[model samples]
Target: MSKRGSGLFFAILLAFALILSACGNNNGGGNQGGGSEGGKSSGGGDNKTLSLLTGGTGGTYYPLGGSMAQIISDETDYNANAQSSGASAENMQALKNGEADIAFSQTDIAAYALNGELMFKDNKVDNVKAIGTLYPETVQIITTKGSGINSVEDLKGKSVSVGAPGSGVNANAQQILEIHGLSFDDIKAQSLSFDESTDGIQSGSIDAAFITAGTPTAAVESLSAQKEIRVIPIADDKIKQLIEKYPYYAEDTVPKGTYKIPEDVKTVAVKAMLVVRDDMPEDDVYAITKAIFENTDKITHAKGKLIKAETALDGIGDLPLHPGAEKYFSEKGVQK
Candidate 1:
């Protein structure tokens, strides 16, 4: 039992302690780098989780976005959760600010964001890109049967709901009114949400409202069930003029049975589309696009039926499509 033996023993003990510490550090680092359970990986991996920005809970975008998110989760290695926001304009901003991975937007509003027109004027959001168009969001000029508002011109001098402030619907209402030779100044403009507008109409606080959503919109349908509603038809010439000026619009019709209207009503509509950040990987966007279109049947919303690959490019026009989405559409022979 000499000093040499004691020194050797101490050195071996220190070396063993250091080795254990290094092993524990490696294990701890691995666990920390690993993602949360049932969550997307922080490191590069096949699975990812994304946030989808949609409109308010009372609107079509919210429920439709939920369905879309579910579809992506079920069909791909991605988990998407839909979040309710202020709809088109806000959704665009979310994409621009990196707050959201994907979003729903109206074709016209998206065009404006790209070109810095109207609401987006002088503040263009160029970092967003399109996935594909979903369906037509019709501009249904709704009023009670006895409101004496059978046409757009009648809306003048009446209390009207022009949609929520800074919303795509607000922009649409403005354009439609301008085409009809009227402006917000010409009417008692009320900035209200869909539910608010309908409530105002029911309470006789507003005479009419301009709703821009897929036909059979929940708000309008609820109003129709309680009171006889009329959807004012846009005259052929005005429709022509509106389309000529705002090329995003296309001729559309609300069939007779919709809202229990007596006959068909002609109008113009913009397409609702999915948009994403420009920085998303091409393959991820492609998979998302594929999952949405290929599993439309799984979407329970009535508008789900309209989400077809054949019409994905309908009102997309010249807006830049995400390369991933473009690749998927091209493979399906659905070209822009």
Candidate 2:
């Protein structure tokens, strides 16, 4: 009954115990990873990841957003990345559907999402909130002198490139035409992207195109270099009515020297804004907003745009500022 039997029994028990411990460790590790939810631990961990939804490569959002995403990844523990999207409307929907954590959108589109108007008429996105404004998007209505189309009203019965479907430019085009007493039914409408629209103009397939972008937009610049393009003026009276009704529209003018055109063109403009989900934790949002605000100058210089942190909250339309962003701006003595 002796020492041999006792030793064998002890060895067997130890082996079984080791196997049970190993299994327990494996199960615990799996659960920990699977149970992980939400962004970086608000408790301060580097496990969180975020995605930024930007506009097409031809527009300002993609580059600016890529820079912002880099800043976020470099300045914080969370990993951030940027993705190109179909501009405002798609970006908003991305945020609502959890496809993106942050996005760049035109102020008017953000307003539409919150109020359930226009494209978002039947499906309102209530989770979006403003982070800040990046820059102004001027509504540029371009055409060559040979096109025989001069003003918004002249667009009637003419082929026009409104903008890519779901883009903020398209909405601006529709509203601009309606203000001029023209509708899609009255004009030959073309839903083309900025690059495509410019091509359309160059090919003479498009009489005029509506391009909403920052000053000196690449698409328009290329068109000007290829031909003498005129950015027709949107009369002041219509601009006034637009701003009165939408409140997001601001009167802007393409300076006389902006393009090859000889004269300045009056236009209605909207701000490009950074947005996030309203349900994002205040501290996380606060940290991100603070990082961006503090680096706004660097971002603007690198991006070559008018991105003033001080004026970020100025024309946010009906979209409420995320509490975290509001706090940072408030501390900096930026009212509202």
Query: Model 1 over residues 129-205: C-alpha lDDT tens digits?
Result: 99999999998888999888988999989999998777899998999899988999999999988888888999999
- lDDT of candidate model 2 versus the reference: 0.81
**Candidate lDDT values, in order:** 0.88, 0.81
lDDT of 2 by residue, 175-220 (tens): 8887878888998999988888888899988889888888777778
| Candidate 1: residue 254 lDDT (0-100) | 95
Please tell me which predicted candidate would have the highest lDDT against the true structure.
1
Candidate 2 residue spans exceeding 4 A from truth: 1-47, 300-305
